[model samples]
Target: MTDQKKTHQPQPPIAVSPDEAARLAGIGRTTLYAALAKGDLPSIKIGTRRLILVDAIRDWLAQHQG
Candidate 1:
């Protein structure tokens, strides 16, 4: 019997940097920062670094539909 190798693909990141989050949310970095400051967009801060979750961006868009 021949051994078959299983290939694994890396999954997309669940957490992203502020710049990437802004790009994904289709808004400018300044606007995103504003929203974050206003508590509109939830963010996770780790050791003086802020990280945005992909799910949070999607949820924000869903709840802010015009």
Candidate 2:
């Protein structure tokens, strides 16, 4: 019998939940939701779950930077 070890690689997330988006943005969930509601942040609805793209989060933050 031979045993094989599996190797795992860490990859950046393409999409994140609202809570995760809030955490990544260093903001509260309410603020995240407000941004989403205002269309300042982009999100997608899937099976009653809302997810934000990592790129969108980055761009949104970049847009707000002075």
Candidate 3:
């Protein structure tokens, strides 16, 4: 019998922190905050933590990219 505990797990991230979202979007922290402050980007607040959806970030990039 083979144990499944050694298997690798792969899961797609549904949400990301502002810093991580910035990194993925190739933008600075300040710019990411600015977008959030300006309501240009959408985020979900869980308690005190703010999370940005990966899908939203992609859409934002598509809208802004020339």
Candidate 4:
């Protein structure tokens, strides 16, 4: 009998600060903040770090793309 093992590769997590998120989304930081304020853009506030999920950003693009 032989044993086999499978290996899984990990993908880097997509993380961005407010500034980077604004740049990546092609929007101003104010607009981003406004959206967050209005609960339009989902964000997580852990400790003092606020993070928006990359997948959420992608979904936003998918639904809001012009």
> Number of clashing residue pairs in every model?
0, 0, 0, 0
Per-residue error (Å), model 1, residue 7: 1.7
TM-score, model 3 to reference? 0.85
lDDT of candidate 1 over 1-66, digit per residue (tens): 999999999999998999999999898999999989999889999998899899999998898898
Residue 4 Cα positional deviation in candidate 2, in Å, after optimal superposition: 12
Task: Please report, as a residue range, the 10-residue window in candidate 3 with the lowest summed lDDT.
Answer: 3-12
Model 2 steric clash total: 0
Q: Residue 36 error for model 2, in Å? A: 0.6
Residue 44 in model 1: shift from native, Å? 1.0
TM-scores of the models, in the given order? 0.87, 0.84, 0.85, 0.71
The RMSD of every model to the true structure, in order and in angstroms, is 1.2, 2.9, 2.3, 3.6
TM-score of 1: 0.87
| Model 2 worst lDDT run, 10 consecutive residues | 1-10
Writing each residue's lDDT as its tens digit, candidate 2 over 10-65 gives 99999999999999999999999999999999999999998999999999999999
- lDDT ranking, best first: 3, 2, 1, 4
Error of 1 at 13 (Å): 0.9
Compute the lDDT of residue 21 as modeled in candidate 4: 80
Clashing pairs in 4: none
What TM-score does structure 4 among the candidates reach?
Answer: 0.71
Preferred candidate (lDDT higher): 1 or 4: 1
